[model samples]
Target: MATLPGRRLLQRCAAGARCRLLGTVAEASPPREGDTIYVKRPASAATRDETSVEMPMSFMTGSVVGKRFYRDATVRRADDGNGWTVMLDYRTLKSPAKRPLKLPSRTLAMAIAAEWEYQESDGIRPFTMPLMKLACTALERVPVTRTKVIDNLMKKFHQDLVFCRSPDDNELTIGVHQKQKEKFDPILDWVNTEFGFKPVVYTSFFGGKQDGELTQAVETVLKKTTDFELASIDAMAAAAHSLVIPLAIFRGKLRIEKAIELIRLEEDHQVILSHYLSLYSGSCFSGLTVQCLIPPGR
Candidate 1:
């Protein structure tokens, strides 16, 4: 069975992959006094009706930024290297649209929508192959919409996450977002089948089994919390290393570059767990660590 810790490791990889895939690389400037601005769907709440969604590009303020926008964008991979060089420029025109462009081939597309969207949110998107591989871990084939795409990724991510919540024992437990529950199920099934992932198991002393009360209570608590998953072989190692017991990181944003170091902090596992086994304890990490997690021990 994929252990509890393994589930979280897997989720992090899939989440990072998903984020990197759609995150656009963009920069923006505050709107000037009179320029018209274009916004996509679900307009910002701060604006009034007619102008609720539309803002003069000129009236923008604060860190209003622009992200990588392709008047037209294209991508092609190097025959020998493991990366892709994406090309993009401005101009609205149609490329051959009979068939979708395949990977390793240059890609181009055009939007024929009545009104095109202009977005200001910015961040770096994930690279392709990794995104595809991560998606394939659960979905037999990719679906077309953004919701479907996110669902597919979450399914793969959830498979290993259940281990952290099994009812038989209690170590630590976290919940999934309500809106994101369906997206997480397929992943749970996949991880359970392949990694021996178990559900959150716990027992409690109660007055009685009257009125489905206990189950309701358990469900209520689970519904309120959030946690990462753990499943694959690689995740197994990351989870074991993370048993920081007291110092392990269970929350907060830890990026890839720092993730590597975070995993390393617990690599030996014993390094931070002195009472369990000291001989194999990891060497002290020079960078911020449990030390960062707490104030100097009293």
Candidate 2:
């Protein structure tokens, strides 16, 4: 079976082994002054057990600053074909990848253009372009790449959080287990009843394979959705690692807070354990320590 690198990291951490991450974010807290952290060398490298390397965390710490390049932004229905396209004065608007930006609806195009119109002449930020980004993906990427995207997204159905159970052997662990079942199971049940598809749940990470019929049922339901909708579903499912969560959210079956709660359960559990360890060992954790638990590949 193929391994999910992220899941492998979680598995190592669950075993309580001290881990040195390679080509990924480190799970351990930052090495203090005079402290050393080992890094796994690439397999092609000569070192069998590479040790003691410090990799600077290169991340965007500040907002992007770009001079606004357009004087005015506008939208018009495409005489070309199916829907609307945004334009910037004399220049036709394009995606960041320089692909022509075409959208499926006049309303969506207007909204995206409005975002451009609202931008200050001094600077423009990519963070402010949610509608544009979604539209760009739908138009520029989805039309050509939908099959591969759908295939990758459908694989996540196997490891959905709804199908995973927490360990139930101890009071602390059992509390988390109960919390998961109480919080996550009814949603699963609801989806089953609503969709006529019941996802298979697993007590252990390695123990489950969703049955062919259930998988086909889910695929059929997805196949009926629009390409744009599938793109959104693929994005949300990848971020939360749960097809059920995104589908539920799309269907308005879960509130935002409930969705966040489900998505952050693992991080919350790690936070609790960190607090416990800090209390017992008298070691303090910086804010970065907790933040590091968030997977960077996202």
Candidate 3:
């Protein structure tokens, strides 16, 4: 598993403490308003030097900002040779907590750089750059909040949308129940086989209980995942409202499109019903009006 460079090491390097001097590079253009400028200075430069600016952690707060500051965004290997880092002009990127943004792979670093490259001069929208947000969350938040994250997922496991079945007896829900059985039953069966305990399906809006062993099994799987994997799974689960769906995707048992279909099953069904009702009503009303206008003898 790839790890981030230690915080203390990066802090010492940032402070220019007992390190060799490297040549400095200046920004291509002057920074605009609200731009946080960080220049990678020579290691021998004094920490208090006016020319040297450490990368501010506030830049990674993922907030909306005005104007693009840098002329270019690029990726480079870290000086320590631990991992790849991104550069806006000459400044190395840092996390919200001021730790070095050491990405495990060059491809990921490049993808993030691409996000930066796409930013417009009028605004820098953090919402548009999902990859960067994911990286920051994995690097800055996951380690500190792992336990709470896992607990939240588990707490919602019993109430997962996939586990709550519509009653088959109701006329309005009969079609939905059939659809659920066709699409969801097989997944439940897979869950049973994989965990060695069948999940309890609930018709109640309140949700149902799963076997304690099954809960333990799922929690164990979550605990064993890497930080990046856990972060991704958490995001997927929140989107789908089903921990099982994300786990299935992670295990390669489900495709992303299919997971999306499952997530919107009920909503999609409602759309179909509305369309059919509109057509039926239009035809029936037209037929009645035509009959009313016709002569009785004819």
Candidate 4:
């Protein structure tokens, strides 16, 4: 499927550097003096203009390492009017590589600014700012790691969750298989129709292989995707454990809620089985509670 129209606009804006920032202003509460946050530059930037790069440092780890130092989070149009950026008071927000966090969509910029605005004064938790992380992955990582990312995703595709069917013989399998047929079959059908190759389904816990032509076709689609789109697909694919689901979502054939339901279908059935077994067989499985199995918000 082609990239979504909105994503197309974003890609165009990002490439041309010719979009105007237009959206609600995002502003954070005032800040207090604290330790400065420092992120290391990616090694790849060494070949580029030195002046273009910002803070230079060594590698660091952890999501919540930094303390809040900026007074407020806000959005501003770039000096060149090329795109919008999230500003930490007078300091511009940069990616981990110290590259400008230029966003093609003002709506996205605002959302990212909100993430920063929501940070606690004691710590700047990078894990909480998903939009900002995504933008950084798109801008700093995707271009350099495109092949590796796609290759890893393709590795997951061979044993994708949707391609594995539960055996229909067992009582538990009966419900799981029915659900799979009802929910997953349609996705497989769409993949068949879209890629012109039927995906292989098997009962093996190890997973099954798809056709070579189908793999190549899916890879081609991924290869053609824009950096932002690929980054998004990568995130969704990792979450769903099935590339087909993300492709369906991108194609507008599946809603995110439906996709989540599908992803959790068999797992939910297992939870039901555990409950039944616990009550009837006088045996309990540790940590089999629904709340633990299925977290809030699906």
lDDT of each: 0.28, 0.63, 0.74, 0.73
Global CA lDDT computed for model 2: 0.63
All candidates: TM-score: 0.20, 0.62, 0.76, 0.73
**lDDT of candidate model 3 versus the reference:** 0.74
Q: Is candidate 2 or candidate 3 better by lDDT?
A: 3
Name model 3 segments beyond 4 Å from true: 1-62, 76-82, 287-298
What digit string (tens of lDDT, one per residue) describes model 2 on residues 195-260? 777867778876478878878777776777787788788878878988889888877898778898
Q: How many residue pairs clash in each candidate?
A: 45, 0, 0, 0
lDDT of 1 by residue, 151-191 (tens): 33333332223222223233321112221243334433543
Q: Give the 10-residue window scoring lowest on summed lDDT in candidate 1.
A: 107-116
* Candidate achieving the largest lDDT: 3
TM-score of 4: 0.73
Question: Which of the numbered candidates is closest to the native, going by highest TM-score?
Answer: 3
The sequence of per-residue lDDT tens digits that candidate 3 reaches over residues 1-298 is 1012233324535785522212223223345554444455666756422122233344556555545566546677887888888776656776655667788887688677667666666556677788888888898789999999999999999998789999999989998999998999989998998888899999999898988999999999999998888999999999889999999999988999999989999988877776666656667775354222222233
Superposed Cα deviation of residue 287, candidate 2 (Å): 25
C-alpha lDDT of residue 39 in model 1? 35
